[model samples]
Target: MAVIAPAGDRITDVAGITVGHHHRIDATARVADPESPGAGWATGTTVIRIDAPSAVCAVDVRGGGPGTRETDLLDPSNTVQTAHALVLTGGSAYGLAAADGVMAGLEALGVGLPMDDQGHVVPIVPAAVIFDLPVGSWDRRPDAGFGRRALAAATVDVAVGSVGAGAGARAGALKGGIGTAGTRIADGPAAGVQVGAVMVANPVGSVIDPATGLPWAATALDLDTYGLTPPDAGDVARLGDLVAKQTVLNTTIGVVATDAALDPSSTRRVAMAGHDGLARAIVPAHSPLDGDTIFAVATGTVHPPQPDTVPPGMNRDVGLLAEVCRVAANVVQRAIVGAVLAAEPVAGIPTYGDVLASAIR
Candidate 1:
């Protein structure tokens, strides 16, 4: 007797959850809406926080050489446990500066790690990013100051599309690049719960259909509607040759937050489940060169208990934790897909529609 929400069921509000974000547009990238002027991130950071402990749990990368930090600590053995606070920024690995701002912000609000008798905070921040300055300039890298600014501007009603780490972002062939959405699961059946997501567009692949699991950008399009071009197909071996000539480092990362009461073990479960959501959106996901990561936090307000919360052989109930994590994983993946679809054409960058057009033609 298991009940799981099907895909595309806008469940932005599951528990008393909310979001806030800030985006900066780069003056460098070619924007489709030349007339559309927005804050340029050339360097900026995004901070997502839940009022209560956004529960804690997560899964690691599916690829080698994936860029990430504090992921290995999810094992429960590490001394690096954390409350709810995830920082997703713009500068590949270098953007880690954003976390400092987030930590400082959280510390100011007294929202993270138990304080020592001395009043010191053990901040555990997990971060991710994408390579933006591929056009020959570090003009799009996020900055630490931006992370601090994002925290100062954090809220429950979070925004999406060109906000946060997504400001200077782009996805597929569409002008699309940053997107955000939320759904409420609190009411008659699932009362007192909420699930929400904030995603950045910097994937090394495409987001597509749920049934076929194929990316729309990778398929043919019927342009009569918009004539979108599919994302440029990279040459396999021939592509490798070209890549060797031109090294392009890319990644897409974000955080998944929930109000479900999850322990360290359960947190890990939620983290794993969130990945399902990622796979649902991106084709050939978790590939090498992709620094995909997820952070699951529990506010401990709601108790969605797991009989065996700890993982086998471990000093925790990882089993039950993993189950809910799986559900969360599904939600996170959907969020990513939503971000891509929601992404609009920007600075001359074709929208997902444009990519579809090229493929169809």
Candidate 2:
């Protein structure tokens, strides 16, 4: 059986994986119809770099309006089975440019697929973006420079909430931001395996239920875990107007990683399960207006039970791989909830905690 690890709440708990963030948050600036350079900048970029020897990778895109780059190559049938880095950012499709900087950085470190005996190499960096044009100056999206800066800042210490790709994110009418969670197998055939997830929550749907003014995931969890509580029913009922004004420009993009050894196919399955967790945390997920995507990376530091060890004629459903998928779903759900809880008010948008406060007042 697997147990949640208490320490290292972020995805960096997965060995060999490091996260970095670069964003610009302007609380007092006004959004200009005309493009502005430094002022009114609320968008940023995040980079997840896989360490030496690369790692198996795959992705699953569920939202109708996903903004991604090089996702097609992640298909199991494709030639590339690993990725050097993954980028998540704001600015809709324009944010995809952030990956170019990560690619350049990795190439500088001599990481990527070798093209020849010469020092030439192409880093496989897949990226996804959330539409956040209305949150800041329309043209102040992330560029290659943002990506490079994020990569340079990569470390095991991850900063959550209103940072990186989530600087301008919104969950319904409430502020959304980056969140992460992790788990480790304590005792079982899967012992020592670690699973973790990090998410930029900007979904079109609400993470809070207006009826209770608590995160939807709170139904099965203790609100105290997120420093939250149930608001007075009368107060919650009074906030009807805010609940109706859901943000339309949104997408929840994230990555799930594990230290367990897995192939591209298995990693893709884990990615799919991450979406299930998304649905569990957010109401009406994977909508046409949202570009929800999840990518999975395996560092292959721990070996799972080999299929050959299973008895013949027995179903393969019950195994270490299955346990990993289950944990991935759980961690993804926790990460999304954490994102909403950690988020701070930005661009005039409130956070779940803000709503709870209003309900109490």
For model 2 the local lDDT of residue 55 reads 81
Error of 2 at 357 (Å): 2.8
Candidate 2 C-alpha lDDT tens digits along 22-119: 99887664433334423488889999988847489999999999999989999999999999899999989988888889998989998899999998
- The global C-alpha lDDT for each of the candidates, from Candidate 1 onward, is 0.54, 0.83
lDDT of 1: 0.54
RMSD of 1: 8.1
Off by over 4 Å in 1: 1-18, 31-43, 114-118, 180-193, 209-249, 304-326, 353-361
lDDT of 1 by residue, 6-117 (tens): 3334233545333445555555555323344333334346776545544554645554445566677667666655545567777667777778777777777666676677
Q: How far is each candidate from the true structure, as Cα RMSD in Å?
A: 8.1, 4.3
TM-score of 1: 0.71
